[model samples]
Target: MGSGESTTRKVSFGVDDEDRVRILRGIKLSEDVLQRMRGVANIPPESSSSRQQTILKDELAKMAEREREAAREELVKTMSRERQQARKEAEKAKELAQQLQKKDSQLKALDAFYKEQLAQLEQRVRHSHMFHRPAETCLNVKNQSRNTAPVCPGLQAQILSCYKDNKDQTLNCSDLVKEYMQCINAAKKLFCLLINSEYDLNCISIAVSM
Candidate 1:
Protein backbone atom coordinates (compact mmCIF):
# COMPACT_ATOMS: atom_id res chain seq x y z
CA MET A 1 0.00 0.00 0.00
CA GLY A 2 1.14 3.58 -0.75
CA SER A 3 1.50 5.98 2.20
CA GLY A 4 -1.48 8.15 1.25
CA GLU A 5 -3.67 5.34 -0.13
CA SER A 6 -6.22 3.62 2.23
CA THR A 7 -6.61 -0.13 1.68
CA THR A 8 -9.79 -2.04 2.54
CA ARG A 9 -10.33 -5.82 2.67
CA LYS A 10 -13.71 -7.55 2.66
CA VAL A 11 -14.16 -10.22 5.38
CA SER A 12 -16.74 -12.89 6.28
CA PHE A 13 -16.73 -14.64 9.74
CA GLY A 14 -17.64 -18.10 8.50
CA VAL A 15 -15.12 -18.17 5.67
CA ASP A 16 -11.38 -17.66 5.56
CA ASP A 17 -10.72 -13.88 5.64
CA GLU A 18 -7.88 -11.32 5.54
CA ASP A 19 -7.44 -11.67 9.36
CA ARG A 20 -6.99 -15.43 8.95
CA VAL A 21 -4.56 -14.75 6.10
CA ARG A 22 -2.56 -12.45 8.39
CA ILE A 23 -2.59 -15.04 11.20
CA LEU A 24 -1.36 -17.71 8.72
CA ARG A 25 1.39 -15.41 7.33
CA GLY A 26 3.98 -16.22 10.06
CA ILE A 27 2.38 -13.91 12.69
CA LYS A 28 2.15 -15.19 16.27
CA LEU A 29 -1.36 -15.13 17.91
CA SER A 30 -2.12 -15.34 21.66
CA GLU A 31 -4.97 -17.45 23.13
CA ASP A 32 -6.74 -14.29 24.42
CA VAL A 33 -6.58 -12.74 20.96
CA LEU A 34 -7.83 -15.93 19.34
CA GLN A 35 -10.64 -16.14 21.89
CA ARG A 36 -11.58 -12.53 21.19
CA MET A 37 -11.64 -13.27 17.47
CA ARG A 38 -13.79 -16.29 18.16
CA GLY A 39 -16.13 -14.14 20.26
CA VAL A 40 -16.41 -11.68 17.38
CA ALA A 41 -17.25 -14.74 15.25
CA ASN A 42 -20.17 -15.54 17.66
CA ILE A 43 -18.48 -18.34 19.65
CA PRO A 44 -20.06 -19.07 23.06
CA PRO A 45 -18.14 -18.33 26.32
CA GLU A 46 -17.00 -21.39 28.34
CA SER A 47 -18.51 -21.05 31.84
CA SER A 48 -15.82 -22.93 33.77
CA SER A 49 -12.84 -21.25 32.05
CA SER A 50 -14.31 -17.72 32.37
CA ARG A 51 -15.13 -18.23 36.03
CA GLN A 52 -11.59 -19.51 36.70
CA GLN A 53 -10.01 -16.47 35.06
CA THR A 54 -12.26 -14.11 37.08
CA ILE A 55 -11.29 -15.92 40.31
CA LEU A 56 -7.57 -15.67 39.46
CA LYS A 57 -7.85 -11.90 38.80
CA ASP A 58 -9.74 -11.37 42.05
CA GLU A 59 -7.13 -13.33 44.01
CA LEU A 60 -4.31 -11.29 42.45
CA ALA A 61 -6.10 -8.02 43.32
CA LYS A 62 -6.59 -9.18 46.91
CA MET A 63 -2.92 -10.19 47.19
CA ALA A 64 -1.87 -6.77 45.88
CA GLU A 65 -4.09 -5.05 48.41
CA ARG A 66 -2.61 -7.12 51.22
CA GLU A 67 0.94 -6.26 50.12
CA ARG A 68 0.09 -2.51 50.11
CA GLU A 69 -1.45 -2.79 53.61
CA ALA A 70 1.63 -4.57 54.95
CA ALA A 71 3.93 -1.88 53.55
CA ARG A 72 1.81 0.87 55.11
CA GLU A 73 1.88 -0.86 58.52
CA GLU A 74 5.66 -1.20 58.35
CA LEU A 75 6.03 2.47 57.57
CA VAL A 76 3.78 3.42 60.51
CA LYS A 77 5.78 1.21 62.88
CA THR A 78 9.08 2.71 61.75
CA MET A 79 7.77 6.26 62.17
CA SER A 80 6.42 5.49 65.65
CA ARG A 81 9.72 4.02 66.77
CA GLU A 82 11.59 7.05 65.50
CA ARG A 83 9.21 9.39 67.30
CA GLN A 84 9.71 7.52 70.58
CA GLN A 85 13.48 7.63 70.23
CA ALA A 86 13.36 11.35 69.41
CA ARG A 87 11.25 12.04 72.49
CA LYS A 88 13.69 10.11 74.67
CA GLU A 89 16.63 12.03 73.23
CA ALA A 90 14.87 15.36 73.79
CA GLU A 91 14.18 14.42 77.42
CA LYS A 92 17.83 13.53 77.93
CA ALA A 93 18.92 16.89 76.50
CA LYS A 94 16.53 18.76 78.80
CA GLU A 95 17.88 16.92 81.84
CA LEU A 96 21.45 17.70 80.85
CA ALA A 97 20.63 21.42 80.46
CA GLN A 98 19.01 21.55 83.87
CA GLN A 99 22.05 19.93 85.43
CA LEU A 100 24.38 22.40 83.75
CA GLN A 101 22.34 25.33 85.00
CA LYS A 102 22.51 23.99 88.55
CA LYS A 103 26.28 23.63 88.32
CA ASP A 104 26.63 27.18 87.03
CA SER A 105 24.69 28.42 90.05
CA GLN A 106 26.97 26.49 92.40
CA LEU A 107 30.13 27.90 90.79
CA LYS A 108 28.74 31.42 91.12
CA ALA A 109 28.17 30.82 94.84
CA LEU A 110 31.74 29.57 95.28
CA ASP A 111 33.10 32.63 93.48
CA ALA A 112 31.05 34.91 95.69
CA PHE A 113 32.37 33.22 98.83
CA TYR A 114 35.97 33.61 97.67
CA LYS A 115 35.39 37.29 96.85
CA GLU A 116 33.96 37.89 100.33
CA GLN A 117 37.01 36.25 101.97
CA LEU A 118 39.44 38.24 99.81
CA ALA A 119 37.68 41.51 100.58
CA GLN A 120 37.86 40.75 104.29
CA LEU A 121 41.58 39.97 104.08
CA GLU A 122 42.25 43.20 102.14
CA GLN A 123 40.39 45.22 104.71
CA ARG A 124 42.29 43.75 107.63
CA VAL A 125 45.67 44.36 105.98
CA ARG A 126 44.81 47.91 104.89
CA HIS A 127 43.49 48.98 108.32
CA SER A 128 46.52 47.71 110.26
CA HIS A 129 49.14 50.43 111.01
CA MET A 130 51.99 48.09 111.96
CA PHE A 131 51.66 45.72 108.96
CA HIS A 132 51.03 48.66 106.58
CA ARG A 133 54.20 49.93 104.83
CA PRO A 134 54.64 52.40 101.96
CA ALA A 135 54.13 50.65 98.58
CA GLU A 136 57.59 51.67 97.23
CA THR A 137 59.48 50.53 100.34
CA CYS A 138 57.61 47.20 100.43
CA LEU A 139 58.37 46.52 96.74
CA ASN A 140 62.07 47.37 97.13
CA VAL A 141 62.52 45.19 100.20
CA LYS A 142 60.69 42.32 98.55
CA ASN A 143 62.97 42.55 95.47
CA GLN A 144 66.12 42.76 97.66
CA SER A 145 65.08 39.70 99.65
CA ARG A 146 64.55 37.74 96.43
CA ASN A 147 68.14 38.69 95.37
CA THR A 148 69.56 37.77 98.85
CA ALA A 149 70.84 41.37 99.29
CA PRO A 150 70.56 43.56 102.39
CA VAL A 151 67.65 46.09 102.27
CA CYS A 152 67.93 49.83 103.20
CA PRO A 153 67.62 50.84 106.88
CA GLY A 154 64.50 52.94 106.18
CA LEU A 155 62.83 49.99 104.46
CA GLN A 156 63.90 47.64 107.28
CA ALA A 157 62.46 50.03 109.87
CA GLN A 158 59.05 50.07 108.08
CA ILE A 159 59.10 46.26 107.80
CA LEU A 160 59.86 45.91 111.49
CA SER A 161 57.05 48.31 112.34
CA CYS A 162 54.64 46.26 110.15
CA TYR A 163 55.93 43.04 111.70
CA LYS A 164 55.11 44.38 115.20
CA ASP A 165 51.57 45.18 114.07
CA ASN A 166 51.25 41.65 112.64
CA LYS A 167 52.50 40.13 115.88
CA ASP A 168 50.13 42.20 118.05
CA GLN A 169 47.13 41.06 115.98
CA THR A 170 48.32 37.56 115.14
CA LEU A 171 47.64 34.36 117.20
CA ASN A 172 51.24 33.92 118.33
CA CYS A 173 53.85 36.48 117.16
CA SER A 174 53.43 36.31 113.35
CA ASP A 175 51.09 37.76 110.71
CA LEU A 176 51.36 34.38 108.93
CA VAL A 177 49.67 32.71 111.89
CA LYS A 178 46.84 35.25 111.86
CA GLU A 179 46.35 34.69 108.09
CA TYR A 180 46.27 30.95 108.69
CA MET A 181 43.64 31.37 111.42
CA GLN A 182 41.51 33.55 109.13
CA CYS A 183 41.77 30.99 106.33
CA ILE A 184 40.73 28.24 108.67
CA ASN A 185 37.71 30.21 109.76
CA ALA A 186 36.77 30.95 106.16
CA ALA A 187 37.09 27.27 105.27
CA LYS A 188 34.75 26.28 108.06
CA LYS A 189 32.17 28.83 106.92
CA LEU A 190 32.48 27.67 103.33
CA PHE A 191 31.82 24.08 104.34
CA CYS A 192 28.68 25.16 106.13
CA LEU A 193 27.52 27.15 103.11
CA LEU A 194 28.09 24.25 100.75
CA ILE A 195 26.01 22.01 102.99
CA ASN A 196 23.15 24.49 102.96
CA SER A 197 23.34 25.07 99.19
CA GLU A 198 20.38 24.01 97.08
CA TYR A 199 22.30 21.64 94.82
CA ASP A 200 24.46 18.79 96.12
CA LEU A 201 28.25 19.08 95.74
CA ASN A 202 28.68 15.63 94.21
CA CYS A 203 26.44 16.45 91.25
CA ILE A 204 28.08 19.83 90.69
CA SER A 205 31.54 18.27 90.93
CA ILE A 206 30.73 15.66 88.32
CA ALA A 207 29.34 18.22 85.87
CA VAL A 208 32.36 20.51 86.27
CA SER A 209 34.77 17.61 85.77
CA MET A 210 32.98 16.48 82.64
Candidate 2:
Protein backbone atom coordinates (compact mmCIF):
# COMPACT_ATOMS: atom_id res chain seq x y z
CA MET A 1 0.00 0.00 0.00
CA GLY A 2 2.81 2.46 0.80
CA SER A 3 4.84 1.68 -2.33
CA GLY A 4 1.80 2.21 -4.60
CA GLU A 5 1.07 5.59 -2.98
CA SER A 6 4.69 6.78 -3.42
CA THR A 7 4.73 5.84 -7.17
CA THR A 8 1.52 7.86 -7.70
CA ARG A 9 3.00 10.91 -6.02
CA LYS A 10 6.23 11.13 -8.17
CA VAL A 11 5.24 9.55 -11.52
CA SER A 12 5.51 12.77 -13.60
CA PHE A 13 9.31 13.26 -13.80
CA GLY A 14 11.30 13.36 -17.13
CA VAL A 15 10.56 15.21 -20.43
CA ASP A 16 13.87 15.77 -22.40
CA ASP A 17 16.33 13.09 -23.68
CA GLU A 18 19.02 13.85 -21.03
CA ASP A 19 16.38 13.82 -18.27
CA ARG A 20 15.04 10.53 -19.62
CA VAL A 21 18.56 9.05 -19.64
CA ARG A 22 19.14 10.23 -16.06
CA ILE A 23 15.82 8.70 -14.99
CA LEU A 24 16.73 5.40 -16.61
CA ARG A 25 20.19 5.36 -15.02
CA GLY A 26 18.79 6.31 -11.62
CA ILE A 27 16.23 3.49 -11.92
CA LYS A 28 18.94 0.93 -12.77
CA LEU A 29 21.17 2.02 -9.88
CA SER A 30 18.20 1.93 -7.46
CA GLU A 31 17.19 -1.51 -8.81
CA ASP A 32 20.72 -2.81 -8.09
CA VAL A 33 20.54 -1.54 -4.50
CA LEU A 34 17.07 -3.13 -4.08
CA GLN A 35 18.33 -6.48 -5.31
CA ARG A 36 21.22 -6.35 -2.80
CA MET A 37 18.77 -5.49 0.01
CA ARG A 38 16.46 -8.33 -1.06
CA GLY A 39 19.36 -10.81 -0.90
CA VAL A 40 20.14 -9.81 2.71
CA ALA A 41 16.53 -9.76 3.94
CA ASN A 42 13.89 -12.48 3.55
CA ILE A 43 11.26 -11.53 0.96
CA PRO A 44 7.67 -11.23 2.13
CA PRO A 45 5.28 -12.92 -0.31
CA GLU A 46 2.49 -10.36 0.39
CA SER A 47 4.55 -7.32 -0.94
CA SER A 48 4.43 -7.01 -4.77
CA SER A 49 8.01 -6.72 -6.33
CA SER A 50 6.76 -4.94 -9.54
CA ARG A 51 4.99 -2.23 -7.49
CA GLN A 52 8.10 -1.74 -5.34
CA GLN A 53 10.29 -1.40 -8.46
CA THR A 54 8.00 1.34 -9.87
CA ILE A 55 8.16 3.30 -6.59
CA LEU A 56 11.97 3.10 -6.51
CA LYS A 57 12.28 4.46 -10.13
CA ASP A 58 10.06 7.46 -9.36
CA GLU A 59 11.96 8.34 -6.13
CA LEU A 60 15.38 7.98 -7.78
CA ALA A 61 14.31 10.22 -10.72
CA LYS A 62 13.17 12.94 -8.32
CA MET A 63 16.49 12.71 -6.43
CA ALA A 64 18.47 13.03 -9.72
CA GLU A 65 16.42 16.13 -10.72
CA ARG A 66 17.12 17.81 -7.35
CA GLU A 67 20.86 17.08 -7.63
CA ARG A 68 20.94 18.46 -11.21
CA GLU A 69 19.17 21.66 -10.03
CA ALA A 70 21.63 22.13 -7.16
CA ALA A 71 24.60 21.64 -9.54
CA ARG A 72 23.13 24.25 -11.98
CA GLU A 73 22.69 26.78 -9.12
CA GLU A 74 26.31 26.26 -8.01
CA LEU A 75 27.53 26.74 -11.63
CA VAL A 76 25.54 29.98 -11.95
CA LYS A 77 27.07 31.31 -8.69
CA THR A 78 30.59 30.45 -9.85
CA MET A 79 30.06 32.21 -13.22
CA SER A 80 28.68 35.32 -11.44
CA ARG A 81 31.73 35.50 -9.17
CA GLU A 82 34.11 35.17 -12.09
CA ARG A 83 32.32 37.93 -13.98
CA GLN A 84 32.53 40.29 -10.96
CA GLN A 85 36.22 39.56 -10.53
CA ALA A 86 36.90 40.25 -14.23
CA ARG A 87 35.00 43.55 -14.04
CA LYS A 88 37.04 44.68 -11.03
CA GLU A 89 40.29 43.78 -12.81
CA ALA A 90 39.25 45.73 -15.88
CA GLU A 91 38.48 48.80 -13.78
CA LYS A 92 41.88 48.60 -12.09
CA ALA A 93 43.66 48.33 -15.44
CA LYS A 94 41.78 51.35 -16.81
CA GLU A 95 42.67 53.43 -13.75
CA LEU A 96 46.35 52.46 -14.00
CA ALA A 97 46.43 53.41 -17.69
CA GLN A 98 44.93 56.80 -16.93
CA GLN A 99 47.52 57.41 -14.19
CA LEU A 100 50.35 56.50 -16.55
CA GLN A 101 48.98 58.87 -19.18
CA LYS A 102 48.79 61.68 -16.63
CA LYS A 103 52.39 61.08 -15.54
CA ASP A 104 53.57 61.06 -19.17
CA SER A 105 51.76 64.34 -19.83
CA GLN A 106 53.39 65.94 -16.77
CA LEU A 107 56.83 64.81 -17.92
CA LYS A 108 56.26 66.27 -21.36
CA ALA A 109 55.11 69.56 -19.89
CA LEU A 110 58.19 69.74 -17.65
CA ASP A 111 60.49 68.96 -20.58
CA ALA A 112 58.97 71.75 -22.65
CA PHE A 113 59.24 74.18 -19.74
CA TYR A 114 62.92 73.35 -19.16
CA LYS A 115 63.69 73.66 -22.87
CA GLU A 116 62.02 77.08 -22.98
CA GLN A 117 63.96 78.21 -19.88
CA LEU A 118 67.24 76.98 -21.36
CA ALA A 119 66.57 78.89 -24.60
CA GLN A 120 65.76 82.08 -22.66
CA LEU A 121 68.98 81.80 -20.62
CA GLU A 122 71.04 81.27 -23.76
CA GLN A 123 69.48 84.35 -25.38
CA ARG A 124 70.18 86.51 -22.28
CA VAL A 125 73.81 85.33 -22.19
CA ARG A 126 74.28 86.07 -25.89
CA HIS A 127 72.92 89.59 -25.47
CA SER A 128 75.07 90.16 -22.36
CA HIS A 129 78.23 89.06 -24.19
CA MET A 130 77.32 91.21 -27.23
CA PHE A 131 76.85 94.37 -25.09
CA HIS A 132 80.08 93.70 -23.12
CA ARG A 133 82.42 93.92 -26.16
CA PRO A 134 82.28 97.73 -26.53
CA ALA A 135 82.69 98.23 -22.78
CA GLU A 136 85.76 96.00 -22.80
CA THR A 137 87.26 97.99 -25.72
CA CYS A 138 86.65 101.29 -23.89
CA LEU A 139 88.39 99.88 -20.77
CA ASN A 140 91.35 98.82 -22.89
CA VAL A 141 91.66 102.34 -24.35
CA LYS A 142 91.61 103.89 -20.85
CA ASN A 143 94.34 101.52 -19.67
CA GLN A 144 96.53 102.26 -22.71
CA SER A 145 96.21 106.00 -22.18
CA ARG A 146 97.15 105.64 -18.50
CA ASN A 147 100.27 103.63 -19.35
CA THR A 148 101.59 105.89 -22.16
CA ALA A 149 104.65 108.13 -21.52
CA PRO A 150 104.16 111.90 -22.02
CA VAL A 151 105.39 113.72 -25.13
CA CYS A 152 108.75 115.65 -25.22
CA PRO A 153 107.68 118.90 -23.47
CA GLY A 154 110.85 120.81 -24.58
CA LEU A 155 110.23 120.12 -28.28
CA GLN A 156 106.52 121.01 -27.94
CA ALA A 157 107.42 124.33 -26.22
CA GLN A 158 109.86 125.36 -28.96
CA ILE A 159 107.25 124.67 -31.70
CA LEU A 160 104.62 126.73 -29.85
CA SER A 161 107.03 129.67 -29.27
CA CYS A 162 108.13 129.74 -32.94
CA TYR A 163 104.51 129.69 -34.12
CA LYS A 164 103.62 132.63 -31.84
CA ASP A 165 106.65 134.67 -32.95
CA ASN A 166 105.91 134.15 -36.65
CA LYS A 167 102.15 134.62 -36.38
CA ASP A 168 102.19 137.30 -39.15
CA GLN A 169 104.55 135.13 -41.30
CA THR A 170 103.52 131.46 -40.62
CA LEU A 171 106.08 129.99 -43.11
CA ASN A 172 108.95 131.05 -40.73
CA CYS A 173 107.69 128.38 -38.13
CA SER A 174 107.97 125.47 -40.61
CA ASP A 175 111.59 124.51 -39.70
CA LEU A 176 110.82 124.55 -36.00
CA VAL A 177 107.70 122.38 -36.50
CA LYS A 178 109.74 119.86 -38.55
CA GLU A 179 112.43 119.69 -35.83
CA TYR A 180 109.74 119.15 -33.14
CA MET A 181 108.20 116.26 -35.14
CA GLN A 182 111.68 114.58 -35.45
CA CYS A 183 112.29 114.91 -31.70
CA ILE A 184 108.84 113.39 -30.92
CA ASN A 185 109.48 110.45 -33.27
CA ALA A 186 112.94 109.81 -31.71
CA ALA A 187 111.47 109.79 -28.17
CA LYS A 188 108.75 107.27 -29.12
CA LYS A 189 111.43 105.00 -30.65
CA LEU A 190 113.60 105.21 -27.53
CA PHE A 191 110.66 104.44 -25.23
CA CYS A 192 109.68 101.34 -27.28
CA LEU A 193 113.35 100.14 -27.27
CA LEU A 194 113.56 100.50 -23.50
CA ILE A 195 110.27 98.57 -22.99
CA ASN A 196 111.51 95.64 -25.18
CA SER A 197 114.83 95.55 -23.33
CA GLU A 198 113.08 95.46 -19.97
CA TYR A 199 110.74 92.59 -21.15
CA ASP A 200 113.80 90.56 -22.31
CA LEU A 201 115.57 91.13 -18.97
CA ASN A 202 112.52 89.87 -17.07
CA CYS A 203 112.39 86.72 -19.24
CA ILE A 204 116.13 86.11 -18.55
CA SER A 205 115.63 86.50 -14.78
CA ILE A 206 112.69 83.99 -14.79
CA ALA A 207 114.82 81.49 -16.74
CA VAL A 208 117.63 81.85 -14.18
CA SER A 209 115.18 81.23 -11.28
CA MET A 210 113.91 78.06 -12.91
Candidate 3:
Protein backbone atom coordinates (compact mmCIF):
# COMPACT_ATOMS: atom_id res chain seq x y z
CA MET A 1 0.00 0.00 0.00
CA GLY A 2 2.84 2.43 1.01
CA SER A 3 4.77 1.83 -2.27
CA GLY A 4 1.67 2.44 -4.37
CA GLU A 5 1.03 5.77 -2.51
CA SER A 6 4.68 6.93 -3.12
CA THR A 7 4.48 6.08 -6.86
CA THR A 8 1.19 7.95 -7.16
CA ARG A 9 2.71 11.08 -5.43
CA LYS A 10 5.75 11.15 -7.86
CA VAL A 11 3.49 10.88 -10.93
CA SER A 12 1.23 13.69 -9.70
CA PHE A 13 4.26 15.98 -8.96
CA GLY A 14 5.62 15.51 -12.51
CA VAL A 15 2.23 16.29 -14.05
CA ASP A 16 1.94 19.49 -11.98
CA ASP A 17 5.42 20.62 -13.07
CA GLU A 18 4.51 20.12 -16.72
CA ASP A 19 1.27 22.08 -16.30
CA ARG A 20 3.14 24.97 -14.61
CA VAL A 21 5.64 25.15 -17.46
CA ARG A 22 2.83 25.16 -20.06
CA ILE A 23 1.06 28.01 -18.21
CA LEU A 24 4.25 30.11 -18.06
CA ARG A 25 4.83 29.54 -21.78
CA GLY A 26 1.29 30.67 -22.55
CA ILE A 27 1.78 33.91 -20.53
CA LYS A 28 5.08 34.63 -22.29
CA LEU A 29 3.49 34.21 -25.76
CA SER A 30 0.60 36.49 -24.81
CA GLU A 31 3.00 39.26 -23.57
CA ASP A 32 5.03 38.97 -26.79
CA VAL A 33 1.91 39.44 -28.93
CA LEU A 34 0.84 42.50 -26.93
CA GLN A 35 4.32 44.04 -27.12
CA ARG A 36 4.32 43.60 -30.93
CA MET A 37 0.93 45.33 -31.24
CA ARG A 38 2.07 48.27 -29.07
CA GLY A 39 5.27 48.66 -31.06
CA VAL A 40 3.37 49.46 -34.29
CA ALA A 41 -0.01 51.18 -33.58
CA ASN A 42 -0.05 51.08 -29.77
CA ILE A 43 -3.39 49.22 -30.05
CA PRO A 44 -4.34 46.70 -27.32
CA PRO A 45 -4.28 43.10 -28.54
CA GLU A 46 -7.69 41.36 -28.31
CA SER A 47 -7.01 37.77 -29.38
CA SER A 48 -4.34 35.48 -30.85
CA SER A 49 -6.47 34.91 -33.97
CA SER A 50 -5.07 34.88 -37.52
CA ARG A 51 -6.76 38.20 -38.37
CA GLN A 52 -5.18 39.94 -35.41
CA GLN A 53 -1.75 38.58 -36.41
CA THR A 54 -2.24 39.80 -39.98
CA ILE A 55 -3.10 43.34 -38.83
CA LEU A 56 -0.03 43.39 -36.55
CA LYS A 57 2.19 42.18 -39.42
CA ASP A 58 0.95 44.93 -41.73
CA GLU A 59 1.55 47.67 -39.17
CA LEU A 60 4.97 46.21 -38.38
CA ALA A 61 5.83 46.26 -42.07
CA LYS A 62 4.90 49.94 -42.31
CA MET A 63 6.99 50.71 -39.24
CA ALA A 64 9.91 48.79 -40.77
CA GLU A 65 9.64 50.83 -43.96
CA ARG A 66 9.64 54.09 -42.00
CA GLU A 67 12.70 52.93 -40.08
CA ARG A 68 14.43 52.04 -43.33
CA GLU A 69 13.67 55.46 -44.79
CA ALA A 70 14.95 57.25 -41.70
CA ALA A 71 18.15 55.19 -41.78
CA ARG A 72 18.65 56.04 -45.43
CA GLU A 73 18.20 59.76 -44.73
CA GLU A 74 20.75 59.58 -41.92
CA LEU A 75 23.17 57.76 -44.18
CA VAL A 76 22.82 60.41 -46.88
CA LYS A 77 23.42 63.21 -44.39
CA THR A 78 26.54 61.48 -43.14
CA MET A 79 27.89 61.05 -46.69
CA SER A 80 27.19 64.71 -47.53
CA ARG A 81 29.07 65.90 -44.47
CA GLU A 82 32.01 63.74 -45.44
CA ARG A 83 32.03 65.12 -48.97
CA GLN A 84 31.95 68.70 -47.73
CA GLN A 85 34.84 68.04 -45.39
CA ALA A 86 36.84 66.41 -48.19
CA ARG A 87 36.23 69.37 -50.49
CA LYS A 88 37.35 71.84 -47.85
CA GLU A 89 40.55 69.91 -47.25
CA ALA A 90 41.25 69.74 -50.98
CA GLU A 91 40.82 73.49 -51.34
CA LYS A 92 43.14 74.08 -48.44
CA ALA A 93 45.75 71.84 -50.03
CA LYS A 94 45.34 73.57 -53.39
CA GLU A 95 45.83 76.99 -51.83
CA LEU A 96 48.97 75.75 -50.12
CA ALA A 97 50.33 74.38 -53.39
CA GLN A 98 49.72 77.70 -55.13
CA GLN A 99 51.53 79.57 -52.38
CA LEU A 100 54.51 77.23 -52.67
CA GLN A 101 54.56 77.63 -56.47
CA LYS A 102 54.52 81.40 -56.17
CA LYS A 103 57.39 81.28 -53.70
CA ASP A 104 59.35 78.95 -56.01
CA SER A 105 58.85 81.30 -58.96
CA GLN A 106 60.04 84.28 -56.95
CA LEU A 107 63.16 82.39 -55.87
CA LYS A 108 63.95 81.37 -59.46
CA ALA A 109 63.58 84.93 -60.68
CA LEU A 110 65.91 86.23 -57.99
CA ASP A 111 68.40 83.46 -58.83
CA ALA A 112 68.36 84.47 -62.50
CA PHE A 113 68.86 88.13 -61.63
CA TYR A 114 71.80 87.24 -59.37
CA LYS A 115 73.34 85.11 -62.11
CA GLU A 116 73.06 88.00 -64.57
CA GLN A 117 74.77 90.39 -62.16
CA LEU A 118 77.57 87.89 -61.57
CA ALA A 119 78.10 87.50 -65.31
CA GLN A 120 78.31 91.29 -65.72
CA LEU A 121 80.84 91.47 -62.88
CA GLU A 122 83.01 88.71 -64.41
CA GLN A 123 83.01 90.52 -67.77
CA ARG A 124 84.08 93.75 -66.07
CA VAL A 125 86.99 91.89 -64.38
CA ARG A 126 88.23 90.50 -67.70
CA HIS A 127 88.02 93.92 -69.38
CA SER A 128 89.81 95.58 -66.45
CA HIS A 129 92.68 93.04 -66.75
CA MET A 130 93.01 93.79 -70.43
CA PHE A 131 92.84 97.57 -70.10
CA HIS A 132 95.30 97.76 -67.16
CA ARG A 133 98.06 96.55 -69.56
CA PRO A 134 100.03 99.63 -70.59
CA ALA A 135 100.31 100.63 -74.28
CA GLU A 136 104.09 99.77 -74.15
CA THR A 137 103.35 96.33 -72.69
CA CYS A 138 100.82 95.68 -75.47
CA LEU A 139 103.34 96.70 -78.13
CA ASN A 140 106.00 94.39 -76.65
CA VAL A 141 103.47 91.53 -76.52
CA LYS A 142 102.56 92.13 -80.18
CA ASN A 143 106.26 92.21 -81.25
CA GLN A 144 107.07 89.05 -79.24
CA SER A 145 104.18 87.02 -80.72
CA ARG A 146 104.53 88.48 -84.25
CA ASN A 147 106.65 85.54 -85.48
CA THR A 148 104.45 82.94 -83.70
CA ALA A 149 100.76 83.76 -83.48
CA PRO A 150 98.39 86.60 -82.56
CA VAL A 151 98.62 87.46 -78.81
CA CYS A 152 94.79 87.59 -78.55
CA PRO A 153 93.65 85.53 -81.50
CA GLY A 154 89.88 85.87 -80.77
CA LEU A 155 89.99 89.68 -80.35
CA GLN A 156 92.21 90.09 -83.41
CA ALA A 157 89.81 87.92 -85.43
CA GLN A 158 86.83 90.06 -84.37
CA ILE A 159 88.62 93.33 -85.23
CA LEU A 160 89.84 91.99 -88.53
CA SER A 161 86.36 90.81 -89.47
CA CYS A 162 84.83 94.18 -88.57
CA TYR A 163 87.46 96.10 -90.54
CA LYS A 164 87.08 93.84 -93.57
CA ASP A 165 83.32 94.16 -93.51
CA ASN A 166 83.55 97.98 -93.47
CA LYS A 167 86.71 98.69 -95.43
CA ASP A 168 84.89 101.28 -97.56
CA GLN A 169 84.21 103.60 -94.57
CA THR A 170 85.97 103.20 -91.22
CA LEU A 171 83.09 105.05 -89.56
CA ASN A 172 81.02 101.94 -89.78
CA CYS A 173 83.34 100.22 -87.23
CA SER A 174 83.30 103.22 -84.89
CA ASP A 175 81.05 101.26 -82.54
CA LEU A 176 83.85 98.80 -81.85
CA VAL A 177 86.23 101.66 -81.19
CA LYS A 178 83.80 103.23 -78.76
CA GLU A 179 83.47 99.93 -76.85
CA TYR A 180 87.27 99.60 -76.64
CA MET A 181 87.59 103.19 -75.35
CA GLN A 182 85.05 102.51 -72.69
CA CYS A 183 87.03 99.49 -71.45
CA ILE A 184 90.19 101.57 -71.43
CA ASN A 185 88.54 104.34 -69.44
CA ALA A 186 87.18 101.80 -66.91
CA ALA A 187 90.66 100.27 -66.52
CA LYS A 188 92.17 103.69 -65.92
CA LYS A 189 89.56 104.48 -63.24
CA LEU A 190 90.15 101.10 -61.47
CA PHE A 191 93.91 101.62 -61.56
CA CYS A 192 93.61 105.14 -60.21
CA LEU A 193 91.30 104.01 -57.36
CA LEU A 194 93.69 101.17 -56.38
CA ILE A 195 96.67 103.51 -56.22
CA ASN A 196 94.84 106.24 -54.26
CA SER A 197 92.62 104.39 -51.73
CA GLU A 198 92.64 101.31 -49.53
CA TYR A 199 91.33 98.24 -51.36
CA ASP A 200 88.19 97.71 -49.22
CA LEU A 201 87.39 101.42 -49.21
CA ASN A 202 87.86 101.59 -52.95
CA CYS A 203 85.44 98.69 -53.41
CA ILE A 204 82.86 100.39 -51.19
CA SER A 205 83.34 103.67 -53.07
CA ILE A 206 82.87 101.90 -56.39
CA ALA A 207 79.70 100.22 -55.20
CA VAL A 208 78.37 103.56 -53.98
CA SER A 209 79.08 105.22 -57.32
CA MET A 210 77.39 102.40 -59.19
Number of the top-ranking candidate, with TM-score as the measure: 1
lDDT of 2 by residue, 1-210 (tens): 755654433322233552221343233335445456446543555568888999999999999999999999999999999999999999999999999999888867755654454455335434433322222222323323224434555755665576567544445555665565556446444443444444344334423332
Please give, for residues 1-210, the per-residue lDDT of candidate 3 as tens digits. Answer: 755654332211111442321332212334445446447434555667978899999999999999999999999999999999999999999999999999888867755654454455446545544433432322323422212222333443454576667554444545554454455455444543544443544444443444
Instruction: Indicate whether candidate 2 or candidate 3 has the larger TM-score.
Output: 3
lDDT, candidate 1, 1-210, per-residue tens: 678889666543332553442343444666566668777654565789889999999999999999999999999999999999999999999999999999888866755654464456445445434222322222323422211122223433443465466533332233443444445344333433433344455434433332
Q: How high is the lDDT of residue 110 in model 2?
A: 58
TM for every model, in the order presented, reads: 0.35, 0.33, 0.34
The TM-score, computed over Cα atoms with residue i paired to residue i, of candidate 2 is 0.33
Superior candidate under lDDT, 2 versus 3: 2
Give the candidate order by descending TM-score: 1, 3, 2
- Candidate RMSDs in Å, in order, are 21.3, 28.2, 17.7
Model 2 poorest 10 in a row by lDDT: 131-140
Ranking by lDDT: 2, 3, 1
- Candidate that beats the other on TM-score, 1 or 2, i.e. the better one: 1
Instruction: Judging by lDDT against the true structure, name the best candidate.
Output: 2
Off by over 4 Å in 3: 1-49, 120-210
